[model samples]
Structure formats: structure tokens, C-alpha cells
Target: MMENHKIAEEVIDAVGGRENIQSVAHCATRLRIMVNDKEKINQEHVEQINKVKGAFFNSGQYQIIFGTGTVNRIYEEIANLGLATMTASDQKKEAVKSGSKIQRAVRTFGDVFVPIIPVLVATGLFMGLRGLVMQDQVLALFGMKTDDVSKNFILFTQVLTDTAFIFLPALVAWSTFRVFGGTPIIGLILGLMLVSPSLPNVWSVAGGDVKPLHFFGFIPVVGYQASVLPAFIAGIIGAKLERAIRKRIPESLDLILTPFLTLLSMIILSLLVIGPAFHTVEKGILTAATTVLSLPFGIAGIILGGLNQVIVVTGVHHIFNMLEIQLLAQYHSNPYNAIVTCAGAAQGGATLAVALKTKSKKLKALSFPSALSAFLGITEPALFGVNLRYGKPFIMALIGGACGGFVASLLKLKATGMALTVIPGTLLYLNGQVLLYILVNLIAIAVAFVLTWMFGYSDKIKEEVEK
Candidate 1:
């Protein structure tokens, strides 16, 4: 571990050191770095390192992809060096004064959410699997349902999955605080205020004619529970407040009083301004989505289906998960969920196709189980080992997914509940057009199989078999 840390430091220096970085962030398995000057960075040297899996440049960011479990530690090391700080010029990266509205919006969204992908995917999978087990009687029978097995098994799983989202503000607060070189505990306090039961409800606080109750007739914040932007704003405020308090208070009582006053002031401010502002933003986003869906479903299906794989590759697909869950909370069912179900099935079909088409005994053996796993919505093996290796499988999966998504949208199929296991969860989206979605997926796999057999097979197998 120590040696790895040293190597990470060296790699950072080789890439151009902390001073060269304008901003930095990490996703599931990649570090996204924006530099003051791209010409100064040595891309080839970074890619040649044994620890680095791949490197690419896209959208003006240099992305360094690492193998599983490696990028996180390197990210931490980079954070420790205070590399995330952006100057006035760096902030211009998303300037409304310069870029078009669409460009600015895209850059802003990517900057805010890309770093949070790993946590989202890990927790999403946990929640999805937990839902599947609890909802399925057969699976629950395998000691998962017994109270005697673990007194709080259900609660444990619920908290594990739900807490990250329920307390998302706090997570963001802590992450952003650390990025700014402030005490993380300050952010935690701000996060707690958002989700606290004691806080006034959104309707009561915002609607009532009361002058918006205050702590000291000064701090103008409201609540924080389950809030996102509020916590982020609070963290920023807390960092500055902490610095001020640290200077004023005596060195002896500094530790105790600084935190107390910082927490109190920041919490109040967050409730007053940040919480309400972001709440409005959230409402506006939902409203916009509803209006968009009211348009022709065929157009919506094509756009969503085509971009689905692209989103997944960039690790922003969790944004869709957030959208789905928020909609489910509001309306109890969402058509977008059906889109994901079909996408998973498409991946499974492609894997099956590759398995059937491959002539190499090793490749065939690898694909067989991977295809089965993909059917269950576990696509990592299929994606990393088969689809990505051969390339054709991924395209086939996308084509099939678009077909299934188009049919699903046309039929108005919606998921009744969420499930991680694709095959078992297909029932959630079942309707009059179930057969069409299935047929489309199978057709996609068949097409992929024929393509792979014709193009990907080795001459050695053909020659020997012919003889």
C-alpha cells in the first residue's frame, strides 16, 4: 500500500503535478483531469505505466482509466495534494458569457455529477439486489427472510441502500468540503439539518404566511433532509465560516467553540437560501421531463435508447437512476424504468450471440456463463470480457435495445417495481407487448451471432473442421 501510494504520487508528478491541474475528479474507474495547458501533459507516458489500464482525451478532459479498486486510492492521494482547487480562470471553463447555453449546461452537469458515479453504481446495485431478494419469494426463502438469521437484516439492507440517497447532501458536503481543505465534520452537521425530522416540512415552511421562522431573526435558511444543493452550499459557507472562527477564537477553546458556532450559522443559512433554491431547481427539472414525455413516444424512445449505452460508458447512467427513483417516489411508476429493463435484456442477448458465434473453446466457455449472468442483469462479465473484447456485441446490443425500447415506449409499458435481476424483473414491465420486446432482443442476438460467426471466427477452426 505504501509503495502504491508512492507510485501514485510519482504518476501525478509525471502528468504535470498539482500546480498544472485546473480541476480534477474521479469516476468508477477513471480520473478526469482538466489542466491549465493540455500541451504540457504527457499522455503517452501515463498510459505506459503498468497500473494504468487506458487513457483517452475527450471533451477537453484527459481521462486516465485504472483497473478496479486502484483509481480510488490514487484519487484520494491527489485530493490530499489539494489538486481540485480552481482559479478564476478555471471557473471560466463553464462561462455563460462565452459558451452557448447548451454547452454550458452540459459542462455544468458533467462537472457536478461525474465524480459521484462509483458510489451511485455500488449503492444502486446493492439497493436493486436487496429489492429483488425481498420481492421474490423463492430467493427470500434462502435465509434472507428469516428474522432469526439476522435481527435487522432487512433494516440493514434498507439503510445501506437508502442512507446514501437519504443523506446525499451530507455526502456531497463532506466530499466538497474535503476538496476545499475544510473540516469535514462541518459539512456533516449541515447534511444532518437537511434530513432531520425536527426540521419544518417543505410545505409548512414555504407556504405558511409566517415570516419564514428564523433562529436569531438573521440566518435565513429552512431545512436540509434529503437535500442536494443545499448541503453543497452549506459546505462552502461552512468552510469560510470555519476559517473566520478559527482566527477569532483563542487557540485553547478554538476546537470546541469554532465548530459549535460554524455549525449553527451554516445550518441556518443553508435552510434559508440553498434548500429552497435547489428545491425549485428539482421541481423545474421534473416539470421539464414531464413536458418532454408528453411529446411523441417514438422520438423519446429513439433519443433515450441511442444515448443509453453512451451514458453508461461515461458512468452518468446513475443520473437516470436518480430520475427514475424520484419519479417513482412522486408518481409510483415510470416508463423510463422499462427502458433500462430492455437495455439489460439486450446486453444479455448480445452475450448469448457471442457465445454461440465464437469458435475458440476458451472464448465460448467464457461467454456462456457471462450471457446467463447478463440475463440476470449482471452485465459486468459480459461487458468487460465478451462484448468489449469483440466490439460487435456492443453494437448489436445497442440496436436490439433501441428496438425493444421503441416497442416498450409504444406499448406504454412501465415498471411496477425495481429489480436488479433482469430476467426475473421482466415481469415488472410485462404488458400486451411483452412478446415484442423479447422477440426484438432475440432477433438482436441472432443478428449479432451471424455477424460474429461470419467476421470474428479464426481461419484455423474453419480449415481444420473442413479437413
Candidate 2:
């Protein structure tokens, strides 16, 4: 506790003291501070603070990297020191009203989907496992026929995988509402309404098995399954509308009227306007992405592979969910997975290089787990915690990803599905392509390690950050 407080105090002082701070917040890896005067910040001093990995000014705020868990303790001490603690929702509300259009959109995408990543990760693992168990070759290798599989076991895996996509809108709406300052339960209920079983199943509509319901003889509405955009749009409107209604109603009547009125109004708007419009826009985006990703010579693969992690850093990588789903549905394979995996794997490579090159104990301690996490298919630990913080490692990783992606394109590599890469990616690719996947990942890691060691990573810089 004393150490945390001391670090917090130093960080506060280094960023121009508490008075220089307009507001303070922290995410999983960094202390995000909005200051009244950027000029008051002693940049070098802050970078020199013990346990401060790296610092940079971006998008009107200063972000000081402290890796995971540490930032929370430091942030708490800042709060104890009388600095106001802003909730994630409060930050979202502020960002929307004040930030640029693109910034607001990216923040919203992040806010809506980040709350649901855990379930998605679990589902990805389940998919990999299920695919492994269901393969005829694997079943035969186990001295069993595909027909001998246990129905109950298949059901269990299917349930885990199906639940997330089947009711995705609820998660999106609930998160969106929470971020947008509305009642989360209300938002979730509203999202549930968008995918209610009373409406025709989206697949049936798509396959021409059923027609979308015609509302008032004109508007066409269907169930939103495996969709993200509709609930996000509806959540914003519902949150804003609920807040507006709460302000005008009597305090005693607020509880009774607000939830009912908010759900009713949002449901009508979503079914008639937001759901249809956003769904159309989502389709257009998926179509365009498909065209680009299918280009000859793997140009799309190389570009996406090289720069995909850069997109992940912006918190808007959730936008690709629809594209991946479409690719798998249309082609039975997703090249996007192969490409993004390279980007994800390269971070581990770069971070490993940093760890190997760094002499500082603290730097080595932080770099190892960040690199390991990236190799296991999560890169934020390495990206924000190490590579992005150091600057050069991140760029080197991008180059490695591009090179790996170009190779994947040339090899015509694809994934059985989206999600899972690096270490975890091996399990899904074990269907006779394990050797190729291993080779590709090794190439990416080697490229990133070589480049970062040669030019990006420096032991001197690590010493300065820890000085």
C-alpha cells in the first residue's frame, strides 16, 4: 500500500501535480489523464519514475503505461489523494460530447464490446475444441466413428458456442447502455427485444425459408442474430432518451415511467428504423470487406495481417466480428484469421526481443508475461504494456506481421474460424496443417524479434524509464 501511494504521488507530481489534472482515469494498462495544461507536464521526469514503463501524449491526454493491475492500485492512490475518479461510463459520456467524430465512434465501439470479450474468448476455445473432437480423421484416429460421438457432449459444446452469437445484441445493448449513462438492465432488455424468438430467425430469413414481418404494411423487420450494430445504435438512443425523460418527469413517478417508456420507445425505433438501417449499413461494410479480402496474390491478407493489431489498439476491433462471420459463412474459411494471427503473433516476438535485450529486472519482469500473453492469442498486454509504450517494438511488430501476412497470402493459408492465434492457434490448425502454421508463426516472430532488437528495442531506454 505504501509503495502504491508513493508511486501515485510521484506520477501525480510528474504529470504537473494534482492541480494540473482536469480529470484522471486508468484502463487495464495505462493511466489516462486529461490535464488543464500539457505544457506543465515534466515529460522526462515522468518517464524516469520508478515502475513507469513509458509515457506518451495522445488524442488530448497523456497515457502513462504501467501494465496490468498496477494501474488500478496507482489510480486508487490518486483517488485517495483527492483526485476525482471518473467511471468508465463518465469517460464515455464526456468523450462523445467533446471528442472528434472518429474518436467518438472508436470509443463507442470499444465501450460496447469490451464488456463482452471474456465470453467471446471462452466461446472461441470451445469452437476450437469442438472442431477438434468432431473431425472424422481425428475420430478415426481415436478408434471411433463420427457416428459414435456423444450427443450430450456435442450439445454442451454447441450451447456454449451458440449462446454468445445467438444473443449478441443483448450484450451489446447492455454494454452500450452502461457506457451511455442509461440503465443497463433496460438496455439489455431492449437488446433482447431485437432478437426475440417471436420474430423470424435471421437464418431462415436469409435462406428464404421465411419472410420478414411487415410492420404497418411497409416496414420490414427481422430478428438480429450474430449482429452488433443494431443494439449499439438502439442503446445510444435508449440511453439518451431515458435520461431526457428522467429529467422531465416527477421524481416519484420517474421509476415507474422511465423503464417502461424507454423500452417501449426504443423498441419501436429499433424495429422500424435503427435495426433495419444499421443492419443494411453493416451488410454493405461486410460486402466491401469481402471484395477487398478476396483480391489475388493475397494483397488484402498481407495488408490486414500487418496492420490488424493497430486496429485492435484503437478498441474498435469488435467491428470485424461481422466480417469474420460472413467470411466463414460464405467461404468455409477465413483468411482474415490467418492475417490477424500474424499481427498478433508478431507482438509476442517483439516483446520477447525486448525481454531478451533488457538488462533491467523490472523491465524483464514486465516484458515476459506481456509476450507470453500475446503468444497465447492476446496482445494488449504486449501492445499497450510494452511495445506501444516503447514505440519502436510496436512498429517492428507491424513489419513482421506484414511479412508474415504476405507469406500467408502466397501460401493461400486460411483459418477454420476466427479467434485464437499463436500458441492457442496451434490447436485449431492441428488438422494436418500444424507444420505450416508453426512455420508461419515462427517466421513472424523471428522477423519481429530481429527488427526490434536491431533498431526498435534498447537497453538504455529501459534504464531511463526505470531511472
Candidate 3:
């Protein structure tokens, strides 16, 4: 108790004391502090404090990483000190206030997309499993050919893999509306209208199996199955329109009239204007992404793999969520996942190397679990808690990531999913690509471990550890 209290007090002093802190919050692994003046805080002093692994300013908050179990105790001590505190969600809102327009926009994208990732991750796993079971070699071992599989069984697998994507617009719209402060149920209904069974299916229309319905002899209408940008934009516009309508309507009629007017106007606008216009824009973006992913000699993989962790430090990596979704929607696979996993794997390897080499028992204890966490596809702990704390390890990890990415691209590796990476990410590669996946990740880990072991730790790190 005495140690935790002392640590909390020192943190407060290092970050320029109670008056500088506008608000404070803690997540699972970091104490997030929003301050009145950034220049007043001493970052080096904060990092030197006991139990403080590292500190960085990102997305309008000064964050101090202190590993998992330790953070909660320190947070309790801080709360007991009678300083102003808020929930992590509220702190994120506060942090938004301090960010630039572009930063805020990127953060908003993260906010909207993060909630929907689990469903996609689950669906991707199902797809990979189904792909494995349905392979010709696997089926032959079971004494059955592809034709021997039941149509009913095939339909069941499709249900597992296809439901989320079939209703992707609804999911995106629902999430967007919630983020933008509008009624989520109304947004959900609006999304359903875009992909309504009454309209021709998007794939069928595209494949020429069916003609699009011609409205007014020029505009053709089709369902928006697995679409993204149109629904996202529509949600933003719909939410604002709903708010506007609510204000103009009388209090007595608010319940009945607000939703009716909002939906009616949004339906027309989305179908005619938002859907057609934004979808073209979405296609252009996807084409550009594909072009980059196909760049000669694995250039795209090398650049993204090396700089992805750097982007994470800046706190705007969530924009990749949109691209990953777009790739799955169009191509039924995400190449980005395989490439980015190298970045996470490299960070884990570097942290593990530190844990093995460090003389400080406290540092080793914190680093081992953090490294394990990174291998399981969560990099924040190992990253901010260990590698970045020592500086040189992070650079070594980046070089390792670039090497792994080059191999992934050279082998034309891709994943069945997004969101999950590194170890749990193996689920996405189970369809005959497991060996290749393991090889790529092993290379990443080995390169990072060797480089970090050789040059990342030095007398400077030892001095910091002693302090």
C-alpha cells in the first residue's frame, strides 16, 4: 500500500501535479491522463518512476504504461488521493477535445469500427475452418469427394461464415449511429432498407445473373450486401437529420413523428444520393488498396509491416479497419492481416529478448507476461511497457517486421480474417496455409529476438533499471 501510494504521488508530480490534470482514467494497462498544458509535464521524469515502464503522448492523452495488475492498484491509489477521475470511455471523449481535426476524425473511425470487429473475427475463423474441412485432400482422407458432402451441411457452413457480411451494412450503420449520438435501432432499420430483399442482390446484379431495377429509366437500383462506406455515410447523415427533426417537432408528437420523418427522408436520400455516390468512392478506394497490395517486389508489405507499429504509437491505426473490411467484402480474403501480423510478432520477440537479458527482477516480471500477450495478438502491453521503454528494442523490432513482411508478400500469403494477429491469428491460416503462416511468424520472431538480444539492451537501460 505504501509503495503504490508513493508511486501515485510521484506520477502526479512528474506529470505536473494535480492542477495540470484536467481528467484522469486508466484502462487495463495504462494510466491515461489528459492535461491542461502538455509542455509542463516531464516525460523523462515520469518514465524514471518505479513501476513505470514507459510513457508516450498519443491521441490527446499522456499515457503511462505500467503493465496489467499494477495499473489497477495504482489507479485505486490515485482515486483515493481525491483527484478528479473519469471512466475510460469518458476520458476518450475528453481526449477527443485535445486532438486536431484529422486526429479526431481517425479516432472517430476507430470508435465506430472497434465494436464490430468481434463478429468479423468469429466469421473469419469459421470461414477458415470450413475451407480446411472442404479441401479435396482432407475430404479424400475421410473417403469422400466434394460431391459426397450434403447440400444441407454446406448451407450450415454458409450460415456461419456469410451472415455477418450479408448484413454488414446494417452493422456498420448501427455502429455509426451509436457513435454519432443517434437512435441505433432506427439506423439498423435504415440499413436493412439498403439491402432489402425487395431489391436485386448486389452480387447477382454484378455477375449479370439478374438485371438491376431501372428507376426513372436511368438510375439502376440494387441491394448493398457487404457494402461499407455508403452505410457509414448514411448513418452520419441520418443521425444529424434525426436530431434536426426531433427539435422541430412538438413534445407530444416527438415519439411518433421523430422516427417517421427521419426514416422517410433518409430512405429517399440514401437510396438515390448517398448509396450511388459514396459506393463509387468506396470502389475507388478499394482499387487503390489492391494496387498497393500488388506492388512489385513486395514493397507494399515492407512499408506497411515496418511502419504499422509506428502508426499504433500515434494512435490512428484504426483506419485500417475500414480497408480490411473492404477487402473481405470484395475479395473474400484480407491480405493486410498477414502482413500486419509481422509487426505484432516482432514486438513480442523483442520484448521477450529484453525479459531474458534484463537483470532487474521487476522488469523481467513485467516483460514476460507482456511478451506473451503480444504473441496472442495484443501488442500494447509489450510495446509501451517494454520495447519502447528501452528504445533500441523497438527499432530492432521494426527491422524484423520489415523482413517478415517481405517474406509474406514473396510467398503471396493472406488471411481469412482481420483483427486477430500473431498466435490466435493462426486460426485464419488453417486452410492449407498453416505451415506457411508459422514460417512467416517464426522468421519475424527470430530476427527481432536476435537483433534485440545483440544491441537493444545497454548500460543506459541498466542505469534506468537501477534508478
Candidate 4:
């Protein structure tokens, strides 16, 4: 308790004392402070503080990383110091007012997607596990052929692997409406309308197994299974429409009228305008992504893998979420996942090297845990806390990412999932590609570790944050 209090007091002083703090909050791993004056905060002094792992100014907040459990304790001490504490959501509402337009826009996408990641991760694992057991090699051990599997068991497996994706639009719309301040239930109903069983299945229509239902002799309609962008746009529009309608209706008529009008209007707009228009746009984006990944000689891998972490530094990495959804929707496989996993693994590698070489016990303490987090598919601790703090290690990691990307591309590796990387991400490759997945990650770690150890880091620069 004393240590936490001391750490909180030091943090308050480092960020120009409590008077400079307009508001403060803590997320899972960082202390987020919105301050009266950014210029007054000593970033280096904050990073150098005993329990502090790293500090950076981002999205209008001076964020100091302190790992997970420690942050909640530190936050309590900060509150005890008479500086008011805000909930994470309340802090975000205030912070949004100060962020640039681009940052705010990207942050919105992150807000919409963050809640949906766990569902996707679980579904991916289900798909991988099913594939593993269904594989000929694995089944051979049980003296079973593919045909020997019971039809009922196969149907049950499909239910686990396919349910989330089939109703993905509902999830997207529900979250978007919640974010945009409308009734989430309305958004969910609207999403269901898009994939109503009465309409032709999208994949079936695409494969020419059936024709789409025609409206007004021109527009075609089909179920929007496995779609993302159209549902996302529809959700935003629906939320806004519901809010607008609520204001115009009488208080007595409000509940019934608002939802009825919103749904009626949104269904028309989604089917006649948003769905058809944005799905085309979404396809174009998917095509571009596919083209890049298909580039000869693994050129695409080299470029995206090397610069991805740099993108992380700019704090716009969430943009990839949409592209990833589109890939999984269209192809049921996400090469982007494999590519980004390499980038994440490389960062872990660089951080590990720093931990082993740094004589500073403080630096060593910070680096080891940060590296472990990176290996577990969260790279912010390793990136902001260690590798980026030392300039050469980040660069070395980028090189390692590029090498791993090349290997992944050469093998044409794709995961059965998205939103996971490094260690936990092995679930996505459990089919028949587990060995290849391990191989690429190992190569990434080895390259980054070797390069960082040999030339990128030394004890001399242990206390300094790279400029």
C-alpha cells in the first residue's frame, strides 16, 4: 500500500502536479490523465519512475503504462491524493473532445470492434479444433475415414463454427447503435432484417445456386450473411434516425413511434441504398487487400509487416479491423491475421533481447513482462514500454517482422481467425498448419533477438528513452 501511494504521488508530480490534471482514469493497464497543460509534463521523468513501465501522450491523454493489477492499486492511491478519479468511459468522453478528428474517427471504429473480438476469437478456435479432428491424419489414428463421421455430429460442429459469422451483422449493428446512442435492440432487429431467411443467401446467389429477389425490376436483394461494412453503416444511420424521430414524436407516442419509424426507414435505406452501395465499396476494398497479399515474391508481406508496428505508433492500427472482417467474410480465412502475428512476434523478440542485456534492474523488470505480453498478442507494453524506448530495437524488430512476413507469405499461410497473435494465436492454426505457424513465429523471434542483442541494445543507454 505504501509503495502504491508513493508511486501515485510520484506520477502526480511527474505530470506537473495535481493542479495540471483536469481528470484521471485507469484502463486495464495504463493510468490515463487528461491534463491542463501537456508541456508541463516531464515524459522522461514519468517513464523513469519506479513502477512505471512506459509513458506516452496519445488521444489527448498522458498515458502511463503500469501493467494490469498494479494500475488499479495505483489509481486508488491517486484518488486518495484528492485528485478526482473518473470512470474509463467518462474519461473517454472528455478525452474525445480534445482529440484530432482522425484520431476520434479511428477510435470510434475501435469502440465498435473491441466488444466483438472475443466472439470472433472463440469462433476461430472452434473452427480450428473442428478442422483438427476432422483432418484425415488425425482421424486415421481412430480408424475413421471422413465418411465414417456421423451426420449429426458434423451438423453440431458446424453450428459452433458458423453461428457467429452468420449473424455478424447483428453484432456489428448492435454495438454501433450502442456507441451512437440509440436503442441497441432496434439495431439488432434491423440487422436481422438484412439476413431474413425469406431472402436468398448471399453466398448461394454469388455461386449462382439461386437468383436474388428483385425489387422494382432493377435492385437485387439477398441475405447479408458474413458481411461487415454495410451492417456497420446501417447501424450508424439507424441510430441517428431513431434519435431524430424520437424528438419529433409526442412523449406518449415516443416509445412505439420512434422504433417503428426508425426500423421502417432503415430497412428501406439499408436494402435500397446502404447495403447495395456499401457492399460494392466493401468488395473493392477487399479486392485491394487480396491484390496486395497476392503480390509476387512476397513483396506485399515485406512492406506491410515492416511498417505495421510503425502504424501502431501512430495509433491507427484499428483500421485493419474492418479489412480483416471483410477478408474473413469473403474467404473464411484471414491472411492478415498471419501477417500481423509476425509483426507482433517480432516486437516480443526485440523486448526479450533488451531484458536479457540491460543491467538496470528497473529496465530488466519492465522488459520481461512487456515481452511476455507481446508474445500473448498484446504489443503495446513491449512497443511503447521497451522496444520503442530504445530506437535500434524497434528497427530490428521491424526487420524481423519483414522476415517472418516473407516466410508466411511464401507458405501462403492463413489463419482460421482474427484478433489474436503470437502465443494464443496458435489456436487459429490447429488444423494442419500448426507447425508452419510455429516456424514463422520462431524465425521472427530469432531474427529480432539476434539483431537486437548483437547491435541494437546495450547497458549504456539503459536509462534513456530514445529520441
> Would you list the C-alpha lDDT of every candidate in the order shown?
0.61, 0.80, 0.89, 0.90
For residues 1-467, write the lDDT of model 3, one tens digit per residue: 99999999999999999999988899888999998898999977886688887788888888888877898999999999998999999999878876789999999999998999999999999989998999999999999999999999999999998988989999999999999989999999999999999999999989999998877888777889999999999999999999999889999999999999999999888888898889889999999999998888989879988988998877889999999998988887998888899989999999999899887787787788888988998788788878876788999999888888888888888888889899999999988898998888889899999999998876468687546
* Local accuracy of candidate 2 as per-residue lDDT tens digits, 1-467: 99989889998898888888888888777788888788999987886677776677655567887777888988889999999778755654554555577776666666566667667656655666677777788898989987898899888877976887788889889999988889999998998999999999888999999999999898899999877777888999899999999999999999999998998999999999999899898788778887887778878767888879888876568767656655544444666777788888999999999999988787787788888878888787688768987789999999999888878777767675566788887765644566778888888899999999999989877656546
TM-score of each: 0.55, 0.81, 0.93, 0.97
Candidate ranking (lDDT, best to worst): 4, 3, 2, 1
TM-score of model number 3? 0.93
Q: After superposition, how far is residue 392 of candidate 1 from its true place, in Å?
A: 3.2
The candidate scoring highest on TM-score is 4
Which predicted model would earn the best lDDT?
4
Model 3 misplaced stretches (Cα beyond 4 Å): 136-143, 360-362, 460-467
RMSD of 4: 1.5
CA shift at 31, candidate 2, in angstroms?
3.1
Candidate 2, position 309, lDDT = 89
Worst 10 residues of 2 by lDDT: 325-334
Quote the positional error of residue 220 for candidate 4 in Å.
Answer: 1.1
Write down the lDDT that model 4 would get: 0.90
Q: After superposition, how far is residue 438 of candidate 1 from its true place, in Å?
A: 7.6
